[model samples]
Target chain A: MRRDFLLSFAGHVLVVGIAALVGMSRAVRDTRRPIVFSVSVVSGGGTPLPQAGAQGTTLVESKPKSQAKAQSTAQSKTPAKGGGGSGSGTFKRQGLGVGVEGAEALGYSYYLNAMLTRVSDNWLNPYAGQAKVLTATVVFDIERDGTVKDVKVEKKSGDAAYDASCERALLVTDKLPPLPPEFPGPRLKLHLEFEQKP
Target chain B: MVPTTGASPGFLGPFIHAGPFALVDVIALVLMSVASWAIVLRKFRTLGRASRQTRQFLSTWGLRTRLGDYEQVAQRLRHSPLSSLLLAGVKEFNALRAEFGNSQAGPELLQHMIPNITEAMERAASREVAKIEGSLAFLSITTMVAPFMGLLGTVQGVLVTFMTLRGTQIPTLQTIAPGISDALITAVMGLVVAIPAALFYNYFVGKAHELEGDMERFESELTGIMRREIVSSQVEQRKGQ
Candidate 1:
């Protein structure tokens, strides 16, 4: 009986050891390769809009530098007629967006752009050369209070790291400035294609 | 799409939520549970039938004074170990009686018969125990493996959860909760299957021992009665002289 007890105890210890070993190996395997979330913004003015989530006012990444320069020059031309901050920044309507004119729309766009940048700042995608470019389309609701809610990935980047970064970007911006009164609607459902560039 | 290793497979979540390893754990648990349940159910019915038949045989043995009555009832009491033990003893007695050619067995004849009867009784007792014990080893084994199986799953789950964080910038609860929960499910299931098996094993052990004791006591009684009959016959022969 004593021998049996000792043997059983040994077996249990062995099991625990194996489990620990497996867990350690898995952890090592997983964390060894990191994904870096590289973010770029495209503003609607024919410039790449701000990353769906980023922080700050001057987060404009156009396909080309000239487009960004033109948008800046246009901002200088538009009077600071919009509410909040220096509303002097011009609203360049993105082709896909519903066109609305004037300084009020431009003010709303700038603030939204800034919020996406903050989200983008928190994102860290996996490293390059690991795989081809992957894109994750994410959708989220912006409440009237500017708190982000129900952020979901509508399209997955076939990589866990990439998809996770997309979700995290939206989540980090738990709160943003409430939509400007010039913008219609109590809540806004926003969609963006977050890409992991090769 | 990159599978979320951290999502809850939950009770009814789609298989896509769990990694292949976690899915295997769930399958193992389900299969083990089914096997354990089957063992418990079959054991209960076998024991119940054996107990009922044993009681009926005991009552019949008490009502009938003649060995012939036991033979007649033995067929109906086939499930009873006590009935089998009695039949073995009686068959030995009759064989001894026939060998003695109608003369009452002297003490010497009785002495030889006792050994033969003892052997037969022992053999029958073992057979009865074997029948009662069918599939019991499976229960014991299931008890031992249940916890380990659960541990395997839990360990795998924790491993998967940690893996989610590998090469990632930040670890969110969303990425961790699923693995943790999946691990917990296996551990819980293991305990659920194991506890009942252990309880039933102990109960079955007790019943088997009780039946074994009854068979042994009856074997001894058979010897004493045969001895008494022989002694009385010898006295009668001396009185006639």
Candidate 2:
């Protein structure tokens, strides 16, 4: 019995040793997901005029310096008459953007842009690399108290997984800062097009 | 994307979040694994010795004409159940010889000695078999219990996971992944502990039975030899008278 006890103890030690070795050898390397969310603003009106001047305000990657300079210069030449907001109208290359429906014209694009950053920060892609390209458009309304309502998918990326992820991103960001007190409207409508390219 | 954080990371990462009940389950399974392995190793060594010694004892017995010639040999083959049976038979035969001397010996002597000797061998056989089969019950119990214990841990973990989902946030993979990990690790550990125990238990049981059979066959063979020797000696004594 004593010998068996010794042998069992040795066996357990060996097993634990091997397990520790394997675990130690395993590289807990950083896993960088390549899915970047870029939003295209479809202003409240029917036209899909991307805010030409508001290009550089994305989440991660910034647009090239030359292009940003050119857009800033171009904006100065022809300031978007009443296209709204008082921030850089320059576009960023591959980063997060906001699609403020008609808020830009009302000069609330800056507020909506900040809100978009918060939502994107909370966004976690469930279908990170499942497809080459995925795009899901979601529409929702923010009450005067900043609570989101009537979140629905406006366009499906043909993949339920991607659609669900986009919806979840919005649902997870259930509340946002209250609409700017200066804004006239009781609520703000948003049309966010979430796209992932390779 | 954001580098995933907040959850403890590693292969045993889920164990960090294990609740009180889950912790108990893990510790119990580990202990079971250790005890089962100890039993397995000890049984292997014992069964091997028994087999090797029994083979040697049988070979030695085959060469000897009389059971008395094997007394010293049986003394040395302690692990062999056959040796114990032989000793029991030889001891009974000696006792019967002292009771009935050559003048009293007859066909009735064979009848009386054979039954007593067989009974003694049977008693020794049962004792040896019991020794060989000892501690096997623990293996059987471990095989049966470890998996269910793991399952219990898993069910409890998932229950807690769902219960926590009642909070402000809707259930997402992030919110649910840790609890699910805790549940799955227990199940995986359960199978790990059970599979080997089950395999070794079956193997040891079979070995014990084989040893038991060996003792039974040796008993009958030894009894036959002892009977033949007695009959021949009695015939010679009667002829001289």
Candidate 3:
């Protein structure tokens, strides 16, 4: 009886230890990876977009000729056209551009862009060399104030760690540029694509 | 007894997929099931013997008018709870009557003996009931707590599952189903342990009540007999005077 008791006790201990180990390993694996949220900004003047994909940089030049043309368009479009011209043309019509401009004014695009930069810098893509290209689409809402809100991954990079890192980075940077006056916002949709170099 | 066999290959592969929580739940449930069966078998045997012995002793005691015959019957069925109660009442009555010496002294003499005998019988009955209820408390606790314990394990399993899901692109059944299955096993185990324990607890309680009622009825009958014997002795003493 004593021997039987000892054997059963040992068996139970072994079972419990193994179970604990399995559970711990699963938990550890889940927590170790990060999510990346990428934001891409495109301007209306037909400049070539950045090559770095979700994490690239673009410079916007405010040239005199472009500003003059934008002012003339605003003046021509206005019905009540005297003192309200400057405020309406520059702040409302010019500020509201399509794509990233609409996204930025709602405060979503800027926040998302900042987030993507941080996530990419943190880790190198392990599959960069082996895989030809990795692409992910991010969906987000732009509020009227030009802030990005409710950013989510519409598609994934397939790697569990990479996917999570993308999401986490998006969540951290939730700010974007003000919407141009042309678009009214409760929510607006913008699609961002991220590509890794082969 | 059914011989233990190796787990079937088809089921074993799936069972291996179940995590540690699921495995523990399965083992605990199996052990509890076996224990419940053992307890049920043992209880049936004990209660059956007690009922048979009590019936036999009562029949034999009723046939003989002499107290000595009843005493002998009580000795033969000492293991029986009913017999134990009867023996206790009879011994108390005999002791009290001997102390008073000659029932011709008065009705007061028999009155004290009746209460003392009743008290002794009741005490003995309670002790016997408690003994019959042995290990039943543990069974009751097992029934109540096993499910909750399983629930704790399941909750932990679910949390791990969700956390893992958050890191993945698309949450699929392959990754999430095992944790859900693991959690459910605990609840099943709890119900398994509790159901039989509750049924047996009620059964044992009913048996105990029946035995107690028998003891009470037997005590009343013994008191009536003592009253008649005392009255007859007193009437004979008056005639002699």
Candidate 4:
């Protein structure tokens, strides 16, 4: 009987140890940022942002009026080039304008804010019962037209249901207000949080 | 009984945080508890009945003289271990008497009766033993498997705990303790279910063996009685001739 107890205890411990190790490795890998390039461009009439890369880019295309004023104020304090169209009103001219744009990009913040608002309003509230907090750093392209294209969830919510909800909400809302013309368009990191009420 | 104070909320509150695996383990433990209780109650009643009937049958057998009277007594004690043995012996005696067909007392007739009586007694012993041993195998299996089931639950709980810790800077005991606790509960439950089952199995087996030994002894005694009767009848027949 003593021998049986010992053997059983040993077996239990062994299973727990192996399971813990497997779980630990998976959790670690899941939490880390993958080292590969993951950004892609949304095709067709949707937000036409360039693919994300080493270069920082502003991706928000259509901003609400309040956001434009905030950008103008922040820009006035700094000596950097202002972000707006170069007066020539065409898609090609806007694209050319984006090529020369520097760091003062208000479009990225506006796009993120809009996405966050939508997430808070539509997805987060309805699914409070099933909500889980997830943090992701996404890379997307901002076409010269300030459209956010190809947003991805870099760090997924451990739960697929919650992650899918976040993804769907982002996809439904298209163009964000345009960034200031001087904003660079290489790759930008946006830290987003989705939280649910307890 | 005096009512005891209620348990503090936190006594088992920590286990709740052990996650889904812990919940599963708790459910399994509850099921095992119910099953163990059921087996204990059932075995208690069955063994009690068997013991009471055996004693009653033995007392009746001691007072009974005629074969017909013994047969009637056996019928009254219908599920008793003694009933089966008595029925087997009586059936064999009747079969032998019919086969002999009014012939004078002979060695062949007596030999046939003894072997038939022995064989019947053996068959009845085996059947009684099986009846008494019912549910003992289930108890043995529950004892053997409970620990492993508990371990499986514990492993699942530990896995969940470690997974929660992987990305963080350092895993602390506070973070890991609940998982370990959850896992251990399964092992505890396994032992709890197994111990009683094993004890009951052994107890029932011992009882069954004891009853079997009694039946074998009684068969020998009955065979001697029958032999004496046959010899006395033969002597009376010789005098009449």
Task: Output the number of the lDDT-best candidate.
Answer: 2
True-contact fraction per candidate equals 0.00, 0.29, 0.00, 0.00
Model 2 bad stretches (over 4 Å): A28-38, A41-53, A56-198, B1-8, B63-65
Better of 1 and 2 by TM-score: 2
Per-candidate TM-scores read: 0.54, 0.65, 0.49, 0.49
Q: Write the per-residue lDDT of candidate 2 for residues B1-241, one digit (tens) a residue.
A: 1113422265556676688888889999988898988888888898889989988887877755566758688879988888889889888887777677444645566666588899999999988888888888999998999999999999999998778778532344434655777777788788899999999999989888888888888888888888878877877777977
**Stretches of candidate 3 exceeding 4 Å from the true structure:** A1-198, B1-38, B61-68, B102-108, B239-241
Residue-level lDDT tens digits of model 3 in B1-241: 1111111213133245556866777677657655655566666777778877877766776744335566667778987786777778777877877878464575567765677777888888888877777766766766776677667667766776787677554454434655565556566566766788778867866776776676667767766766666666667768888
The TM-score of chain B in candidate 2 is 0.92
Q: Which candidate has the top score in DockQ?
A: 2
How well is each residue in A1-198 modelled by candidate 1, as lDDT tens digits? 244345445554566478566654554222111111112322222212233222112322332334444555443222222312323333233211112212123345556555655555455554333346676767787665688888888778788887887788678868878765444333555655565443
lDDT of 4 by residue, B67-171 (tens): 547767787887678788888877777677677725875634765567777788788878878777776777777777777777777777667767777786534
Which interface RMSD values do the candidates have, in the order shown? 16.2, 13.8, 21.0, 22.3
lDDT of 2 by residue, A1-198 (tens): 778888888888888778767766774442322111224421121212233213223322212323333443233221222232333332332211221212122255555566665555455555443445766778787765778888899889898986887787689888988877655444555656666543
Q: What does candidate 1's lDDT look like per residue over B122-188, in tens digits?
A: 8988988898887788778878998888788778878877876799654444346546755677777
Local error of candidate 1 at A53, Å? 22
For each candidate, the DockQ is 0.03, 0.15, 0.01, 0.01
What overall lDDT, based on C-alpha atoms, would model 1 receive against the true structure? 0.60
lDDT of 3 at B87: 79
